[model samples]
Target chain A: MRAVAALCLVIGLAVPALGWAQEDKPAEFPEKLEIGISTDEIAISSDFRGADLTIFGAIEGYDPSLLAQSKYDIVVALEGPKDNNTVRVKERIFGIWVNRRSMTFELVPESYSLSSTRDVETIAAPPVLNGVGVGIQHIRLSPVGYLGDGSNLTEFRDAFRRLKESGGFYQRDPGGVQFISASLFKATVKLPANVPNGTHVVRAHLFRDGVFIAEKALPLRVMKTGIEQMISNAAYNQSFAYGAFSVMLAVLTGWLASVVFRKD
Target chain B: MNIFIILGMGAAVGFLSGMFGVGGGFLITPLLIFYNIPPVVAVATGANQVVASSISGALSHFRRGTLDVKLGTVLLVGGLAGATVGIWIFSLLRSLGQLDLVISLLYVVLLGTVGTLMLLESIRALRRAAANQPVSLRRPGQHNWVHRLPLKMRFKKSKIYLSVIPVVGLGFGIGILTSIMGVGGGFIMVPAMIYLLRIPTNVVVGTSLFQIIFVTAYTTVVQATTNYSVDIVLAFILMVAGVIGAQYGVRVGQKLRGEQLRALLALLVLAVGARLAVDLVVTPEDIYSIVSEGVYR
Candidate 1:
């Protein structure tokens, strides 16, 4: 009797899966979403080192019956301010290194932190990710003014990505996003100490069967505050005054040291 | 970089600065390069730190009334002009992606030449001492090509009468080196003053420190404003530790005689130069590298 009941359960599970497979119909996306950052504004002080950015959110409107069926995979990416960048490749030319080729990429973010529940390749097809611009590799690279073959240009683009990735600007963690419950997910992104101060965009994407069904985005501000803020502002905005101040401070320090450590 | 690393490097460099009377940029720059700080940032920040130490040393001399203010002023003028031009060239090299190569080559040449000369001179002095031969500290000033220039001036403090053109030219040359190499130019400045200008040893130290003050300050300001590469926090950390390290280094310097000290400093200088030279001759692990224009944002 137990065996018969087990068979019935198996058939019951397979039938619905088969029916859904045969349906060949598109699935509904998330009905609603809610998201937030650990802090709306990040204030970097003089002693600022680095911080972890916790991005958490909850999804809604998924079938209640399939709650335990691994319903969705989430990807959260924090894209810092975007700007144009030039990537140069150096070649060893007769005992010296020189830049031989160069390419410019528009729409490159100053910093990018990406997190996903699974490896991005497993999350979706390359075409799908490329179309949606899901990963660092998927970042749009439209060379503005360059004279190079398409294949060679791609190498330069790859080199840019590689270099940035090593520099802590471009980051990704496959298992960074954790599913807390049936509908809630969270991710932790590392904010580097040298993170550029600006308005950053945080995006949370939900995927099912390698298809992007829904996503949400929020703005987070990384800024300098307190005396550090004033100094940083002066350094860039009122650069001359800042430079003069730095020089003066050095001189004063030197003067003080001389007085303190004078040989009697 | 880790705080510990910065602190450690600062301390090590400071000790050297105090002992050898070098600006420590010679030591600091190569170490920073090893730690992977961008060469541009290293050079700019190195100048920023050097300004502080030079000021401290210069002030002590000023108090002793050993510093030649008149001579310092003249050098300062030439330094200012040279610093501006050097900064212009630095920017040009940065754009061409040749800044690192140029700076490294400069280090190799400067360190190699200076270290070898110091080593030979110190060894000769050591032999004279061991052979029980009387060692004359200073040779009488002799007429040289430098004396033929125009604008003659008498520096009572240094007790020398020389052409202002050569003084200005020397200062200008050192200033150009300061901006590019991020040093106070003390290592070269002292030697130039003693050997070329034939300045008295007592006046040379104070005067070199005096001139270093203005040149490095100008370099720091220009680098901060034009390049925006000066990391004030990094500079402060280096300065504080450097100042302290210099104190300890002073104590160590007192124990070593002049010949031994110069010989050791020369060996250290040559070692660093050799390491840099090897990097050029040997194939790099990765020939391809990337650099972003402007502050990396």
Candidate 2:
């Protein structure tokens, strides 16, 4: 009788499991994150000043109890294209300040702007943030060569972060992310006036109860337009032609000036 | 960054260059550095500006039958070779993070020496004028150690048979300066041609200008291709303003006594050198800095 009862219970559970599998529905705890940008491309002109970029996102399959308790947190970051960055520290040598030591960080973002619901440190543990590499302070900055004794690693990293922050290439807005509704959020990140042109990425991370749950990323292209950009492009892409043209222009200008100002 | 400021700066430097018979590249590069433009950009763009400034002077000399084409061509050959070597050194220093320091140090030495010499010469000239003494000219026929060198070349335009070795050497040295310091090197080249090589004073300015146009033009092209530091817009604005200002400056210069103009120019050069020296000795605002590797794109 006990075996029959056990068999009946197993079949009952199997039927619901089969039904759930057929419906292709995930468990309630598996919340999903989705983000959208109004435009995937940003056009920068000669007169471009720093401006704000807004990103909209929604959380799917969120728990009602967790939402009521304000357990959900969102952090969105817009990271510029990555390149090798070198940081140098100057020391006094022979009454002159000179660059004495330099460390190059491999594959780091040229520019980074972060927006979060609250202070990133308060929202999650330091280890969690570091693991996710979400915050500017938490981003990975691995040095490009051998580091002896691992000493001065922190010093160089701190200096690099400080310089980038001071130069306005790296920025953060702790309160820039806000929840318009229970499941939707809006985040605003800054685009510096000197923002690099390349394929940037807009990354959105959702954390629940101090635990990271869902993350989404979308590519954003930053393009420079107008004559300035055209000139820059020519300089890099068709450098030889551009160089010849510059020489020609200078020659013409000089010849014209002499002709016009001839006293003979 | 400000167009008006740049235009004004260009005009002021142009006025001084016109008055002193200079290319103005030295003044432009340092002034740009002070205005917060990167030293690399300033150096490259200054070379471009020199090309424009020199072309007109060279052209005028050509029409006046003062320029020595054969000598200028020989100098150009050496200048091109030297520029290639200079660009290599520029890239090396840049990668080592010492390019700015080296540039500043070189300017300090060049400007300091040139300024002091000019001041001393001008003071002597003023004293002589005050005493109603006759102006003494150096004998052109006097032989120097430079004449002993082999591979002599006849430059009929200057009416002198000179060693190609010294001419090419001088051109090479000036070429290096043109690439690294962003100066047409006329200030040094003119004096060297007059005193060292004993070239005829009548043709020295024209020949130097001819060589300067080609050397600076070559430097501009190479800098654009290798460093991508030549700013065309900045160069154009500076050229336009500079040419306009040079016209007025020539008229004003004609009204001034030679010694007085030299004294004023000496003071200006000394002031710029002193400023650079102070920046080097004094404590900087920040010691830590960062450079992003790769192109902006």
- The TM-score leader among the candidates is 2
Go through the candidates in order and give each one's DockQ.
0.37, 0.59
Question: Candidate 1 on A1-264: residue-level lDDT in tens?
Answer: 000000001111222223322233245553344566545676677566766677767766666665567757788888887777777676777876656667777767888888988888888889988876878988777787766668787787788888889888889989998877667777877676667778888877777777776666778787766676676677778777777777887887777787788888
Task: Write the residue-wise lDDT of candidate 2 on B19-71 in tens digits.
Answer: 88888999999999999888998999999988888888999899999999999
Computed on alpha carbons, the lDDT of every model, listed in order, comes to: 0.78, 0.87
Q: How big is the positional error of residue A185 in model 1, measured in Å on the Cα after superposition?
A: 8.1
**Model 2's DockQ score:** 0.59
**TM-scores of all predicted structures:** 0.79, 0.93
Q: Please give the distance, in angstroms, between residue A220's alpha carbon in candidate 2 and its true position after superposition.
A: 0.7
For this target, which candidate reaches the highest DockQ against the unseen true structure? Answer: 2
Clashes of 1: 0
